[model samples]
Target chain A: MDFELSEEQRLLKDSVDRLIAKEYRFERRLDFLRRSEGWSRQTWQGFAEMGLLALPFAEEHGGFGSGGVETMLVMEAFGRGLVVEPYLSTVILAGGTIRHSGASGRMAETVERIIAGEHLMALAHNEKGGPRHSLEPQTRAKRSGACWTLTGSKIAVLHGATADELVVSATTDTGSALFLVPAEAEGISVSPQKGYDGVPLAEVTLEGVSVQTEFVLCEPGMGEKVLAHVIAEANAALCAEAVGIMGDVFDTTCEYLLTRTQFGVPIGSFQALQHQAADMLIELELSRSMAILAALSIDSEPPVRERNVSAAKAQIGRSGRLIGQRAIQLHGAIGITEEYKVGHSFKRLTAIDAMFGNADWHIDAIVEAGGLYTA
Target chain B: MDLNFSVEDVAFREEVRTFLASSLPDYLCAKMIKRLHLTKDETVHWQRILNARGWATPSWPVDCGGQSWSPSQRYIFQEEMALAHAPETQPFNVNMIGPILAKFGTDEQKAKFLRSTANLDIWWCQGFSEPGAGSDLASLKTSAVRDGNHYLINGQKIWTTQAQNADWMFALVRTDSSGRKQEGISFLLIDMTTHGITVRPIETIDGGHDANEVFFDDVRVPTANLIGEEGKGWTYAKHLLGNERSGIARIGLSKERLKQLRSLEHELSASGQLDERETVGLKRKLAEVEVQLRALELTQLRVVSADAHGANAGAAASILKIKGTELQQRMTELVLELAGPEGLALAVDDHTDGSGGWQNPAAQFYFTMRKVSIFGGSNEIQKNIIAKTMLGL
Candidate 1:
């Protein structure tokens, strides 16, 4: 087994690192967050120009054929920079769903547009009520001549307000299905808002929104697999991002400890604080391992892929919580201030931990499947 | 970037499993599966079988009777042994003194000791931690003074594991008194049967006599037993401890434990012992710990693979120790929890033999596992190392 990145992967990682280091400074991030749009479209186009938007699509689709490892590299850099682009919502969650579902015609051209930096999309799968993190949508779909009308509310539609089109999940008479519906389609309204971490989220209401029969991403028999695959991909990217955030928080805390002197010496010289910092580093490394493992497992068979992704999401959640808390405690007041980078890291971590499946929820899922091993 | 083992590694693993299946005695496997204590002879027997295959000391170089296995092959061998219910190669012989002697011993010392050490002809035990020198090992007062061609050893060593069964004890004795505490110390190999030496058993909370208080009253030892130069015992000890931390996770052991736990869960349902809710709760706890183990297992692979590329993330070493020991203890605790009322039975009897895993001393195993975090530099001490060395705290 090998863990070393390939030459191309390393080069890709270096470019992302350099781009983020040069442009996404802390002050620039704050300024971007303060804007009316809450993020930068210019930065989004810049990512497309860098070919990141094209990274995960297949070569047959006029895109660079890449896999989860490449996504891991990019997301990790985004985490380090605290970049607030719509890559996850647009590229992985929405565009990725269409690409992986093997949908041709309009859907395939949409993916082409996404790769060419001409389109933005968001996934509207999660909804309110029922069990937490339930993948089966409460949204309903109605049959119409040469069309389907969707009638349901999709809560927390990540980056949905700005998307050119939305990938919507709904239940039909047979089972669940997904459709690519235009954002400005009749009977669609979005309550636009920003998450606590300052990323865009919207409550998308689909009141009999009409979609042509041709826009069905998947039917009942195949939709579940595609949704699970894309969700795992998103979670893997998020896991990688969490690792990047944890690493930076850990390093920043260490720097603070070495320089933040009190009581006649650096406060870090205290055994209690030192041990906390050590614990943070341990969590960071473990989280990183889980992230890599999750990335590698994205293409495996369904059972293995789902189980590993849940395991990684849970582990990253737990580690992120511990590291974030320790970072705050170690830095004292500065760690929680709005101006400080560490607090922002903690907030992003909090959001990531809550998204898809939190640690405890994922643990419940694993046990529900009769644990990770058998006789 | 990949976790797939190569074709050669898979075959090597198969070879190891085949050897274990053919040669490992059922009686010892039974003891290992249940966490029952094994007699010293049983441990020696297993180690010899492995040694005869040239597999017992795979980490050592080929010249020292070790296999020329790559790191992954060696890892597979170690992993297979654990999965097959085989006992670990005696740490004092294989992991500790043997490597030191191979790395730094004189020609005569290597010729005399290396083979027997691997073959289990010399059952070695460490004599390091004194009553006062648990974590502060530098303060050890055990002394060796020169008497012509020999040195007289004196003072005491506590927590010498399996001392009663040990044929030899490798120790760090203070050879000079006028230097720093960490200095003036020497690594010595002493015959356990020597005169003026006494081994007093220290009964642990598990009710096992696995350790002792070894006292040296002017015990005479040849200067030839000295390893490398004098006053470098601390450096050598560090090397030995570093080796200990490499495979500290023991992922295969934890995996096997989880497998046994799952089977036991099935038995619990078949016996109509646990209610549905209780079964679900138990499974949840088991999955949490299993997930934790998987995380550590991947972390270990990351470290190992990084090492293959000549990038040593030694800082991740302490992560292994802390998480590895915690999972071990958690496993024992889970077993005890499964045992429940049956565990409280006063009779010292097992419901099943080694064939079905009923001889488990669940509470005792739980208590015994407590020593893991306390020993081998202790988790606290490991954190201190990480704090100073890795985190720059």
Candidate 2:
């Protein structure tokens, strides 16, 4: 019923917004983007100190049990700032998955480290042959005595190069399972990959990597649920991040239009470009709504959760592409260059779009599940 | 800060829902729910039901037969109507001209028009856009020359929707030729029965005569018919436009369409194996549209709520106008896509009850909606408003 955020939520949003606005400037990100690692450790430690890393975990687990909406607020601010931390990987993907699926002692320890900003973790789920969902994971895990050894490659592991722990999705004799292993475990090597957004990704090769029995985050054969939850969170987070980027796109474009004069007047005064800007505004607003709805359904029981997650992902995916493409189109050749921040935001939007489930993928899922109308 | 409805709002919501269920006729509700073309009688019947309950003009002031509910209450009431498939009060009378007259009408003007408009005693139409003055409305060339307590009007208006069915019209006409285009105009209320006034129906691509080209050849009108001062018509026109833009958004209608789309998707999915690309793509797009619609609705609520609280964001009204129309057009596009070949079929004898026959209306509707973004100040004008008024462009 009510759509307004609570005073507390608004305050939280303002705090996050102000923090990112002040400290996480694009110049710093540009500097970091040129480095081999996409982000600086000190900036991440500052995020930890600000409790950004701990917002999504339960209070009892030394974190805030903030739901998806709050997480969206934080991520949106991060995205607007273009903060180069692996918050999406460490906090949202691996850390969020473990926290939601009845955290084990080892998993809880990892969550604690992630929240403290002492360590990072990335979800190593997508195989080279599989799409983002890849529910029936290709990574194989065999029971050798009491311990399990996983052998396979996880492609495009987001922030894989920086993480200390890797949450690997594998299919065993019992079905799908989520295993948490050390990033530097024996027989595990990562080939660093640079995403279009300049974020560090890695194609991780696991050759008989040993994982303790207790490291299984979810019950055997119950990993599909864990994977679903992770996908939902990641998808929702991506939507939120895109909204932030889109906001910047609008802002940057608006400023450019106002300052750039044509026909002896600011182009912003021209109705044609003005109309286009209005449409972009509409798109941005629409994407924000999708992000909010997706975040709202993050904790809901399946099929409903799955549907909403797909809906959000799909909408955001389309919005990201539309806005990114439009931003470039509106900005002209200067936008395609490296100097303009709009280009960078455009790239980031496209990359977030490709992650999780793309718009088409989610739409298909939503249609299959009959989620188009009911939710 | 709390998003939860207050206890009074919850009670008011239930009251509205109950009234809509018990009071609005089933046939009319069915027409709205099924997206069937509603007869004038069906629309009038539901409007009467709402008027009888004194819930007809929630947006009007108490003195104007409005209940003067809080913004949140109005929001809840309007939302329930859409959710329950109850017919809406005709916007031409209730929203467009009524509010304009209430705000700027002379005492004589109010006595002559206000009551009839609220009760639907007189069907009303707008005459603003001329063939030349579309988005540049101030450039309207329709002229009203003063002559001994009356004005002789001569001009042509295009895209006048529902003019053929209307009994009265509120028009923008030039009153002075020497001043700036905006300053010379005036708002005039003209009876449809006046001599020298003609309405020629313009059949839209939708195959319906929803619009008309109205011509005036020296039509005479009493000076008393003018709302506000002669030169102030431009101001009143601007005021009327704000209302027009808001009404055009029609967030409630979008919600209804979205609901229909969801159900249709389910039926389609159940018939057989869905084409993975088509089915999923449609579902996700639906969700995406729903999200935008939701945000627009919330923005609308905030605006209405502020007005109810005696504050206003009138300057940002264009924001809703642009988004609302775009979302509506997008929804129609999706509906067309879902309807597939059936959507493309023209309304023919097969589908109509011999009244209109069977051709699917989706394609026609989609075509009609293409004008939504181009109308109501062209959304381009809206951004200008936002830039100057909201962002200080």
Candidate 3:
């Protein structure tokens, strides 16, 4: 039907675009990343004030009740800015899980804190060697008296170091369950490190981390379903983000080709390089379409949502690689330098590809789901 | 943005599907489904069938006897036709010169050609590329000097597809030799039966005679045959080439070929002819191509949607061409791969056996598909267009 954004959606896009332009400059982002907190708390508060932090939550939860398209707009803008904040981890991953799992009472209070930028949350679902789509956690959760103790490690907990609470997935006697463990819990330790794209990541060790019964976000056996819901949303967000990064990277590469002269003319005038640039654009456009498809289908039935999310992730992963590599190749030596925005965008795109299942993983998932031939 | 078709669009698709199901000839559908080459008469017969239903030229304007469907409607019609194995309407008349004539032809010219073109009463072929002007078509040396009342044509054109079957040829001739190479050209419509006009068949690698080398030696064309102004052929040719490139993506055809490949794979697996490793590899390759095809389909929808909103989709068309052709070639290759030894059979007439070991024309189809990337301006030229016009490179 219609591909045009509504007037309200256009305004949201313009506001986000303006915000990124004003505050999330490439150099400013680097400065924010270098701080002790690894990101600008002021910018986090800015997102809250701008209503982006509350965009995806229910209006009853003191939020905007915005849909996937709205979240995609903000995520894409964040991607263009290469914003070094934990929005994916804090909001879509952890906050989304809580919302989907029917978090109430204390958990709902935590969601409010997250929306207000007063607290940060990271979903610690990935274990050391679990399958990419598997949410059956290896971490153990045992209830004794009035408390449940978690005892295992979650590797690559996005923004775990800075998060105020960790939405930890653990296997219980009945099945898997989600527990909100405080970052400052007595038996928890976080080894934080800068990821490939200079974003804060941590390997969290939850050694006998005790949590009250109220901290469990959902009933037993609901963890996998909740995690699946959260992952789908995160996948959609990452796909949109990759589209943004690839788009910018493509623009930067095209600009470089037009301006950077070699021999007697702009290097872009050369047919060989021009063809490569065209391939990059093709990849970017395809990725964009896929991202839109994923975003639009994020809230569908589980099977349909998973299929679309996997399709988007697979396409984005494949196209992102081509666009990123071709972009660097077109930019020549300058593309690989840290000083250039193109390279930084390439780095972020690469990270997004590896996150939430890469192309090969998603393609395999699709093949396993009746092999794409039937569809 | 919503990707689902509207209820009306869905109803239109159903209407088309029902029409195709009941109307398409079984013999023609059999040829199409098997990728067998259809004869010129067969193609014209199918066109007549569509003409009888008043759906022959979906893309043309209503005033010119076209259905004047929306872009989405046209796309759905095309997709449904391909899926139903309906023969393609010859592009020369329907897609190429017809649109140019509709836009620029004089009232007299339109009166003479528009109805006949839509009814397939006249078969047309393009005469733009010369021996030395394939991608660089502006440098063509096909000259048509002015005589008393007609242009004295004396030049040659190469890779003129379907010329053997054409009753007329819409050509580009060098009307001026002093100005820029692109400025001196003139668009002329030449009768194929004109004296001194030679249509020599050029056998392609696929062992087919679909193209030719058309030589013009003192061929006379009435002044009335010229579509537009002299020395403006390059402009008209560019417009025609844009139309040419737009449909050359062949998304519907690729979807059909992909579906055929899957069926072949299933057939091979059911008979235990494909090993487990080969089956897995085939599935993986099919999955990859399927994903790319789906993306291309969505990209096409975006372009169509953008066009409906009055936005320029020039570069998006180029993108579709590049990906569409590549996917086409890839699917054909997979078809051949699925065919195994049967694909290697050369000079095989039909893909049928009494024992149900259907012999696919995959090898010939694959060989023919190579031209998809090369013709209608090579994929390389499409990239050049994208770089220059879209990226400003």
lDDT of 1 by residue, B1-393 (tens): 878988988888899999999999988888787777777778889999888888889888778887777667766777888899999989889998889999989999999999999999999999999989999999999999999989999899999999999999999999988989988889999999999999999998777788899999999999999998889988888887656333768888888888888888889978989899898888888888878988998888877776666676766778898988899999888888898877765326532334333424787788889999999889999999989885564
DockQ of each: 0.78, 0.28, 0.74
Q: In terms of DockQ, which candidate is strongest? A: 1
Candidate 2, B1-393: lDDT as tens digits = 233578998999899888887887776665565455565666777787788888877677689887767667766777788888887788779887888888988788888888888888788999999999987888999999999999999989999988988899999999997978899999899999999999999977767777899999999999989988988888876776665333445777788888877777777777853576677676667766765665576567656645655565645478788888888899788878777776665766422232441126667668878888887677767777766652466
Give the number of the best model, judged by lDDT.
Answer: 1
Q: How close is candidate 2 to the true structure, as a TM-score?
A: 0.89
> To one decimal, what is the Cα RMSD in angstroms of model 3 from the true structure?
1.8
- The whole-model lDDT of each prediction reads 0.87, 0.79, 0.86
State, as a TM-score between 0 and 1, how close model 3 is to the true structure: 0.97
**Candidate 3, A55-162: lDDT as tens digits:** 888877888888889989998998889988989999899889878988765565676788899999898988877665577888999999989999998888899899
lDDT of 2 at B123: 86
TM-score of each: 0.97, 0.89, 0.97
- What are the runs in model 3 whose C-alpha is more than 4 Å off? A373-375, B243-248, B350-360, B391-393
Q: In model 1, how large is the Cα lDDT of residue B340? A: 88
Error of 1 at A260 (Å): 0.6
Write down the TM-score of model 3's second chain.
0.96
